[model samples]
Target: MAKAYANPDVLVSTEWVAEHHQDPSVRIVESDEDVLLYQQGHVPGAVMIDWHTDLQDQVVRDYIDKERFARLCSSKGIANDTTVVFYGDKNNWWACYAFWVFKLYGHAECRIMNGGRKRWEADGREWSREPEPQYPATSYVAAEPDPSLRAFQAEVLKHQNKGKPLVDVRSPGEYTGELLHMPDYPQEGALRGGHIPGAISIPWSRSVNDDGTFKSARDLEKIYVREAGLKRRSPIVAYCRIGERSSHTWFVLHYLLGFPKVKNYDGSWTEWGNTVGVPIEKGPGGTASAEASS
Candidate 1:
C-alpha cells in the first residue's frame, strides 16, 4: 500500500515490529484496557504498561506527573532515545492512549504497532510468557508536558463557542444519549449520556478496518474529510466517554492524516457529562450535521 500520511513513520506494521522488536534501540510496550491481557499472551519481548495503574496518578483524576513518568520509563528500560513501539488489545485503544500520554511528556520516538493485538494474534505470530530482560535504568528526565496536544474543559468550551470542529469518537448509542457506555459494557458508563453541544459523532472504529488494521489514506480522507467534514488547518479535538478511545482518533487525524493541529480532550464525557450545567445534546436532531470546512 502507498504511504498514507505526510509523516507515516508514527505507525509500524506487525512485520516491522517482529523484525526490530529485539533490537537494543527498540522497546515494545503493550498498553491494554484489560490489565491482564498481556499476561495471557503477548508479542515476544514486549513489556506491559497497564493503562490505569502505570499511567494515571494514584490519588488524583490526572495522569502521573513528569517525575513519575521518568521513573516509569526508567523501569521499562526506556531512555530518552529509545524507540518505543506501542501495541495492545481493543484495537489499540489503551495503547494509543498510552502513546498520547507519552507525547504529553515529549517522547518523540514513539510509534504504534499497526493492527495491534488483534492482527498480531490473527497472524499466528510468536507469543511468549518469558519476560524481556530490562536494561539498566538510565537517568531519564521527561520534557515539559506539551499543552498543545491536550485539551482542557475550558478549551473545549471555547471550541464549542467558536463553532470549531469537535469530534466525539464514542459509539453511536453513546453519541445519541441512548447508551451511557459502549454497547455491552456497563462498567465504564458515565453519569450522563449525550454528547457536547455541537460536537460531531464520528466513532473511532471508522478509522480502522475489520482486521483491525487502519484503512488506506484515501479511505480515511473520505471518512474524516468528506464524511465528517474535517479540514487540515482547522483545530480539531477528539473525545470519548473517557480520553482513551479519543486518543486513537487523535493519532489517526494528527499522525495518520497529518492534521497540523489536533488535541485529545482527556477529560472527555466523564468530566463533561457530570459537570453541573454543562450543555449537552441528545437525539438525532440534536447535533448539527457536519459539512466540509474550508
Candidate 2:
C-alpha cells in the first residue's frame, strides 16, 4: 500500500499538505503550471512557479538548462536544507517535472503531491484567490547540473532504429499520428506514432488514479507486471512528448520499484518523434518500422 506521506520517495497527499503546509522544513510549490490557473488562486503557503516557462530549459532545447535550473530553486527560496513538496494539476506532470529538475541538480528530498489541487478542492479545502508576492532576493549556491539524470537527443539518436523498447507515454491520438490542439501532448504533435519500432505505448494515464493520486505500490505492481512486461532485469527507458511525463515514470521505476537504472529519454519524442532525420518506427506496439537513415 502506498500511503502518500509514508513513502517520502514517491508521493504526498493533500492531507499531508494541510498538516505540514507551515513547516519551515517543508516548502510547497503551487506550480501553477498554467498561467491562468496561477493568476486565479493557489494553496495558502504555496509559491508559484510556471511549469512551462519558469521550470523548463528555454535554451539548449534539451534537458533543464543547467544554469537556469539552479537559479529556479534558489529563486523559489529552496535551499539545500529545504524539503520540497510539489503539487499541481496536469496529472502531477507539473509537479514531477520540477521534482525531476530538483533531482537532476542533486536534491533528493522532494515529493510530488499525490492528487494535486484536485484533491484539495474536492475536499472543500481553503483556496487563496491571490498569488503570493515575491520574497526578498537571496542567493542560493548553484551546482553544476548533474548529467546522470539526463538523457540527450544524441543519445536517443544513437539508439534510434536499434529495436529498443522506446516507450511512448503520450495520448492515443498523438500515438496514432493525429494532430492535437495541445502542443505539449507530444512535441507539438510531431511524431507519426504507432510507436518506435520495438517501442511500448504505455500512456502515462495508466499510472495514476482517477483522483489523480498514483495507484498503490501493489496496484502499480500489477499494472507494470501485466501491462508493461517489466522484468527483474529488464532495462527500461521511458519517454513522453518533451520528457516531463517520462520523468514521472522514471521516478516511479527508479524510486518506487528500485529498478537498477531507468534512464529517462529527456528529449523524448519531442526530439526523436519530431526531428526529421533521426529514424522513427511508426506503428503499433513493437512494430519494428524504421526509416533507417544514417
Candidate 3:
C-alpha cells in the first residue's frame, strides 16, 4: 500500500491539467530552465513565465518586487482566487522554483503539474505552437514576501552554527570539492567548489521517478527520514547552484512530507562560494573550514 503525501492537493496530474488548463478559473503556467522551450510547443493554452526574465530582477540577483509581481500576474490574467498550475521541463525543476517564488509572494492558490512536460509528452498529449492567447488583464494583488519560506546567507550560516540540517540538493560533484557546478553545466557560477558546512548531500532528482512524477510518500520517507534522518518537525534548509534545484527538494520536504518549516536558500553556492569569510566543507568526509582566498 502506498502512503499518501502530507499535502496531495498541492500536486495535480498531467491528466488533470489537460482537463482544467483551459478553464477560465485556472491559469496554466509553463516555466522552464530553457526559456525557449515553450516556443517549441507546450501544453495548449499554457503561458510562459521565463525564469530569467519574467521572475527575476534584471539589475539585481533578487526576484521581482511585489508591484511587479502583481503586474505580472495581472498581465497573465491571474486573479487572486484563480488556481495557478505550474509545469515545465526537467521534471518540473523550474516549475517548482516558480512555485516557491509564488509562495513567497503569498499567492493563495498554487499547484504543480506532476510529471510536467516530460510526462505530458510521454502520455501522448497534444501540444500547440499557436500564439499564446491573452486573456483580459486582472487586478491581482500580491502580498508582502513571506520571510519564512526564504533563507539568506547570514540566516543559513546561523542555522548551520546551530546544528540545524541543510540539504545540498546538487550533484555529488558539486557537493564535493570536485566541481563548481553540475557536470557539463557552465562550471562558472561560483569561484569555488564544495558545500556549506554540515549540509547533507541529497541530489534533488532523487525525489522524482523516471516518468518525472514524484515518488510515493513511502519511498520518500525511506530516503529522507529513514536514510537521511530528517524529522518532520525540524526546520531545514535546502540549496543548489542558484536555488532552483533545491526548490524541488523544498517542495518534497515541506508539502509532501509535511515538514513544518523548510526554507530554500536562493543565494545558494553562488553567494556562499564567492563570498569571503564563510565556512565550507570539502569531500565526503565533511570537514568544515573557512573558504579559501581567491
Q: What's each prediction's TM-score?
A: 0.95, 0.84, 0.95
Model 3 segments more than 4 A misplaced: 286-294
Residue 57 miss distance in model 2 (angstroms): 3.8
Task: Give lDDT tens digits, candidate 1, residues 1-294.
Answer: 224676688889999999997898999999987877787888888888888999999899999999999999999999999999999988898889999999999998999998999999888898887755577797889988899999999989988877788999998989989998888778877888999977888889998998888788888888888766777898988999779999999999988888899999999998998888878899753234343332
In candidate 1, stretches whose alpha carbon ends up further than 4 angstroms from where it belongs are: 1-3, 285-294
RMSD of each: 2.0, 4.3, 4.0
- Judged by whole-model lDDT over C-alpha atoms, candidate 1 comes out at 0.87
| Candidate 3 lDDT over residue span 86-203, tens digit each | 9999999999999999999999899999999999999999998978779899998999999999999999999888778888989888899798878878745688888887888888
Total backbone clashes of candidate 1, pairs 3 or more residues apart or in separate chains:
0
Separately for all candidates shown, the number of backbone clashes (residues 3 or more apart, or on different chains) is 0, 1, 0
The lDDT leader among the candidates is: 3
